[model samples]
Target: MRTIESYLRMLLIMTLCYLIAEWVIDEPKGTVLFNPYVLGFLFFIFLLVISFEVIIGVLERIADQLTTPEQRVALEEAKKQKALENKWKKRFAEWLIGKQTTPEAQLILEDHNYDGIRELDNPLPPWWLYLFYLTLIFGVVYLGYYHLFGGSDQKQNFEQEMAMAKEQIETYKKTAASFVDETNVTVLTDASSLESGKSLFEIHCAICHQNDGGGAIGPNLTDNYWILGGDIKSIFLTIAKGGRPGKGMIAWNNSLKPQEIQQLSSFILSLNGTTPQNPKAPEGTLINQ
Candidate 1:
C-alpha cells in the first residue's frame, strides 16, 4: 500500500508540473510531447522521480540493515498505534457511505418478489443525494440570474460583438486607403477626387511645377511631352518615386497617401491639352500632339 501511494504521489506531482508548464507555454499550434521544451521538462521530471525512488529504496535498505530485531518489533507496534490514532477517519468514511444492513438483517419484500427472487429495500447513497440537492440549488440560481434578472442572452451578446466587429472593419477600410501601391492604383476622375488632388498639388508640387503645372524648376505637365512616360501608371510612379535620381522632384510617397497620390495623378492628367499662362519649351519626346 505504501509503495502504491508513493508511486501515485510521484505521478500526481509530475502531472501538476506538466499542467503548469502547459499553462506557461501558450503555443498556438498546441503543445505536444514531441515539442523540445515539453520533452525536456518531462525528461527532467522523469529523472527527478527516478532519483527520488532510488534514494528512498537505498534509505529503506540502510534502515533495514541498521535496525535490530527489537527495533523492528517496536516499529510494528508504532504502526499499530498510528492506525489506532486514525480510527476516526475510517469511521467518518463509513458515516458518509451510511450503514449497510447485513444479509441476515436485510428486510426482504415478499410482495415485490418476481420469479422466486425477493427484493431488498436499499437506501440511496448519501453522496449521490447530496450531489442531486446541489444540482437543484444550481438550477435555481441559474434561472434567477439569467431569466428573472436583465442578464443579456447569448443572441444579444453575439449581436453586440458582431456590431463592434463591423464598426472595426469600417474603421479599417477608411484608414487602409494608404495601403494602395503602384500595381493596384487606378485613375479617380470624380470632382471631389480632382479637387483634393488639385489642393495637394498646389501645396507640394506647385513649388517646382508652378501653380498651373506649366513648368518652373520641373518639366511642363500641361504638355503631352513626358520625360518618363505619358501614361497614368507612369505618371503615378513618377509622382510616388520622384522624377529621377539626383534630379529636382523628391519622392512624395512618404509625404502623401496613395489615394491622395491617385487624386493628384488624375488632376495632372486632366491638364493635358489645356493652355497654361506661360508654357515652357517642350523638353521630352511627345507621345500625343
Candidate 2:
C-alpha cells in the first residue's frame, strides 16, 4: 500500500475494469467519465482502494505485534535498504526542480519584510524554466510558419470549414433521402417534392391507380374509401411493404427511394375529393374525414 507498485496495480485494475465495462456497454457518445455506469465503477474503485488500504494497514499492525525484536530490526534494515535502492528516483525528482535551499540555508532578504515575514532568495524550478523555454521556441516556429509564410488565418480557416460543412450537408441530404422507413415516413408537401412524386406515380403507379388516381384495376383513390387504413403512416407502410397478401399491390420499398414514396403518398392524399374522368367505383370501407 505504501509502494508505487501498489498504486500502479490499482490503476491497472481500474483501467481493465473500465475497458470491460465499455466493451459491454459500447456507448461512444458523450463524456466517458460522466456516463452513469462509468461513474458507478469509479465509485466502486474508490471503495475498493479504501478497503485495500484499511486491510493492509490492519495486517501490517498485526504483523508488527507478532514480530520479535530481531525481526523488527531486520524489517527496519530491509526498509533502509529499499530506500537506498530508490534513492536515485528521489535525486532525479530533485534534479527536475533545480537546486533548492533548506530552511536553515535559505538567505532571508534584509529589506523585504511584511508582518515579520521575510522573503527568501529562491531559484526558479528547472521544470518551469524548461517549459518557458519550450514556449519561446514554439512561439518563434509558429510566427515563422504562420505570419511570415502567409499560412491560412482564422477567416480563411472558417471559410474552409464552412465549405466542408456545406459539402457534408449536401452528401447527407443525398443519402438521407433513402434513410427512411414506414416508422419515420411523412408526407412531403413542397411543390418540387410533389412534382417529383407525381412523376414517380405516373411512371410506376398509373397502370393500376390510373393517370389521375381515379382508380383503374385498383380501388378508388379519389374517394375517402381505402383498402387499407388511409392515414399517412398506414399509407407509407402500404407503399413500402405492399398491401395484403399474394394478389395485393407489389411492394414499392425496393423500387422507389423513401423520399419518392413520401412524395407519392402526399400526392395520393391530395387526390381525395377531386373529380376525375371515368372514375372507378369505391370498393373499401369509407373513412370519415
Candidate 3:
C-alpha cells in the first residue's frame, strides 16, 4: 500500500549515505573521491525528492481526516503500508548481515560452555570473506611481481612520464609558438607586430629612451649608431642580454618574452632616422646590413 515515492525516497537516502560513507573513508588517502559539483547536484535531487514526498504525504493525511469512511480507509492503508515497509526492511537486513539465530550461529553458541554468557557467533557474510581472501592473494601476487621478480618500478614510471612530457613540448615547439631568442629571431615587419612592439617599448623603454624614441638617459634609439651593434640581431641581443659591463643596460630577456623582444627590436629598427628632440649622440658601431 506504500506509494512508490516512499520506496524511491528510501533508496535515494541509502545511496546518499553510502556515497558519504565512502567519501569519509577515502578522504584520508589523498585521492579525490568525488567531484564537489556532482555531490551538490545529488544533494539538490535529494532535497527535491524529500520535499515532494512530504507535500504529498501531508495532503493525503489532510484529505483522509475530512470524512470517517476516508479516515478508516486511510488507517487501513497506513497499516498495510507499515507492514509492507517492515517486510522489505527485514529482508534487506537479513540479506546484508545474514539471518539471526541460524544453525551455524547456534552451533557456535552451543560449542562454547560459558557460565551465563552466549557468544553470538554469527558467521561473516560470504561476500565479505571472499573479498578478504582476495586481498590476501592479491597482496602475495603483488609482492612477488613487484619486489621479488622484475617489473615496472616507480622510477621507470616517473622517467617515462617525464619523457612523454618532453616529447609533447618538442612537438608544441614545432607548431610556431616556440621560444624565440635574439640569435635565431628575425625582425617582424608586419603592421600588427610593429604596433604591438611600439606599445611595449613605450611602456618599458620609454623611461630611459623617453617618449617618441628620443634619447634621455639612454642612447638615441633612432640613430644608426649603436654601442652594442646596430642590426636587428644586435639590437635584439642588446635588448635581451643587456649592454657591456656598467653601460647601464641590463638583460631584458627576463622582463620580455622572446616574441615581445623580437617585436620591440623590429620597432627599434624602424626608428632609424626619426627626428627626436634632445636626442643623445649615437655611441655604437653602425652596421649597414
Highest TM-score scorer: 3
CA-lDDT, candidates in order: 0.82, 0.81, 0.79
Q: Which residue pairs clash within candidate 1?
A: none
Candidate 3 lDDT over residue span 149-227, tens digit each: 9778999999999999999977766676666766567878999999999999999999999777878888888987777
Which lDDT tens digits does candidate 1 get at residues 1-289? 3564577678898888777777777764345555887888888988998899889989988998899999999998998898689888546544556555678648544467688888766665677788889999999998998989968989999999999999997777668865666766787888999999999999998888888989888999999899988788888899899988888788889988888889999999988898888888887898874
Q: Give the TM-score of candidate 2.
A: 0.43
Order of models, best TM-score first: 3, 2, 1
lDDT of 2 by residue, 109-198 (tens): 557779998876677778788899999999999999898998898999999999999999777866775666666677777889888878
Q: Counting only residues 3 or more apart in sequence or on different chains, how many pairs clash (N, Cα, C under 3 Å) in candidate 3?
A: 2
TM-score, candidate number 1: 0.40
Model 3 RMSD in Å is 9.1
CA deviation > 4 Å runs, candidate 1? 1-179
- Residue 267 deviation, candidate 1, in Å? 0.3
Instruction: Give all TM-scores, in the order shown.
Output: 0.40, 0.43, 0.52
lDDT of 1 at 62: 99
Number of the candidate with higher TM-score, 1 or 3: 3
Pick by TM-score: 2 or 3, better one = 3
